[model samples]
Target: MSAPRLTLPSPAKLNLMLHILGRREDGYHELQTIFQFLDYGDEITFAVRDDGVIRLHTEFAGVPHDSNLIVRAAKQLQEQSACPLGIDIWIEKVLPMGGGIGGGSSNAATTLLGLNHLWQLGWNEDRLAALGLSLGADVPVFVRGHAAFAEGVGEKLTPVDPEEPWYLVLVPQVSVSTAEIFSDPLLTRDTPPIKVRPVPKGNGRNDCLPVVARRYPDVRNALNLLGKFTEAKLTGTGSCVFGGFPSKAEADKVSALLTETLTGFVAKGSNISMLHRKLQSLL
Candidate 1:
């Protein structure tokens, strides 16, 4: 008998330390970040079908039916393949929008990974990752399903075994536009790029903090509060910040403290992606 259809978790990511080293002539910022997969994120369920019609069951609130990343990914896959296949894409969005958490990118990555198997398309990891890179720099990490140190507009990923564990992530009530942050005249674009090396221990910093703090006071305040617990740092651009703790209980303690202070939020610890791990189990 054929294996059961797969339901995957497209995990969110925290920029443990995001640094803007410089800008390329192509207008993309060269950056460095320790990317960690979160325990919670968006979920996408897929089922193979005989008829070659793609359908989306979600309205996705503000996003259009046709323009959703899942659909876009599906079309990207179907256009390249000789096989005829259909899928039912259902997305349960747990990650916040405009939070620099790569929610949409993860969804797109999951779609690409799922359809490759469901439709029986023969593309391997490198091919899927290459396709994912064209979609977005962040998409490739989700395609690979592991934590890493990333560079080059956040595309170059080196699999990191990161003293990997629980990290207390805090998403502030305010949403920061990544484009706006990158576009700001005050953004430092020449901090000197660092080659991928050992994942630096906790003291690593995000260069965008000063720029983000000056414009978004709420983020600064959140960082201040989290600092009381551990050496807190801003993730990606701003709006969401995180601090590392040794244990889940400690992480939860910090999260509880945030509950009384900031309002809009997502507080969770680090985790490995289960999407393809489950696939491995079935295989």
Candidate 2:
């Protein structure tokens, strides 16, 4: 008999809008953003081990085993919860690294939730999300599995229901370094915060776009090509640009046209993450 195993979707997220209000004393930017999930992403599988040794069987090039976010997340949860069991983790890598699409953070969150379930730790979402935040700023949104209005270095989340639209997302060949983008003197760090509940429509702008577009020609080219079909906007400190369409057919049509010159995909925007939906089905 084999040890129990579970596989979960590690979904990607888009920062629908990102506003950098100021730089904090700690050098972290004060950001206000909306995070919405996409139906498409990587998948992660976990098998339990009673001997209590956390391990990731899948190797990511350039990211060592212990340093991988999935491994770190599993180790963190095991230590924090004082859970005796360990996990063997594997990932079907699909999402591009450093694409500004919350791939790593989502994988970390999935590890936390998966181990929590398989280990029978019975930890609540709040506790899990708090642990996840120490891993990355975007992890809490994945843990909570909802579209959110996020503030305070992307930790403070207020659930929001944004209209789910089909998205055509283009992947630029180059990976944009988020640290480089944030540290650029040309980057906008002073967008005024939105005070009202349910942010207004015209606020769908990412503050990092200008700086990112200037530094990465691939990103700039993607934006220019995708912009021809719809209102293309960068997500977070992006190497990925996305535009919303009313229907999957419309989004797919544009994806087919643009993928000739660049790589891209079409997926429906989701308020509730697919990971949570799968977890719920087991209940």
Candidate 3:
């Protein structure tokens, strides 16, 4: 009999507030940021293979099969668990690449969690998160599936319950390169860290904004346009800019006005990821 396919949501995340603490000698920056999920994102489906041949049937433009994070994540889990099983993976790509929405990282996390459950490896969350960290700094938060305050290259996470607001996220017509932003000479590398609990009010700012806005007019125009309605901020090193509203109606109302000239979407912010919600349903 063919193995039953398991499909799950791979939610996108926003860095609601991003602060750069400092840079390490290894060329990594220490950061403090708050993460929250969007109810909207891509979907991934997995089918287990007994003969141990792993494959990703979906094609991501400009991303090689070996270099794809989803494939790497699945291979990592299969190798580390010493499991004689593999998976056929497919993703419905909804989130834009290099949009600063954690698209690739979320897909990797979903693969790790999905494979662990499907293959019956019985690995713990901490072990899985550690494996995820090897993929990217953002992967662990997605693996943990919590809205959190993240620090220390974004590996150290403290769960926090921030307001779940509806967001109008505008997609600028250009892709922003994270490496380019981080390497810019004018980028800020020092913002003092704050208390772990009770994040200060009016703290939603991204340090990468200045460099990104200066480099990409599309991002700047989107930010400027959105700022007319509410406080707009960039998430991570962004090609997408967002502003939060009190309700879905308010968010959609604004999105309708701006989208005539720019591409965008409205989604309710989520403290608990859809991935974890789906996992709980399986219990």
Cα shift from native, residue 264, model 2 (Å) = 0.7
Q: Write the per-residue lDDT of candidate 1 for residues 1-283, one digit (tens) a residue.
A: 5434778888878887777888889988888887877777788888776687788888878889888888888888888775687887777887877777888888988899888877777799899998888888999988888888888888888887676556666677787988888998988877766656666767377888889988998888988888897888887886777777777787777777786777534444444566666567756
Lowest summed lDDT across 10 adjacent residues in model 2 is found at: 195-204
Instruction: Show the colliding residue pairs in model 2.
Output: none
* lDDT for each residue of candidate 3 in 169-196, tens digit (9 for 90 to 100): 9989788988899999999987888887
lDDT of 1: 0.79
Q: What TM-score fits each model?
A: 0.91, 0.98, 0.98
**lDDT per residue as tens, model 2, 89-157:** 889999999999999999999999899899999999999999999999999999999999999999999
- In terms of lDDT, the poorest run of 10 residues in model 3 is 196-205
Give candidate 3 misplaced runs (Cα > 4 Å).
none
TM-score of 1: 0.91
CA RMSD of all predictions: 2.3, 0.8, 0.8
Quote the positional error of residue 227 for candidate 1 in Å: 1.2
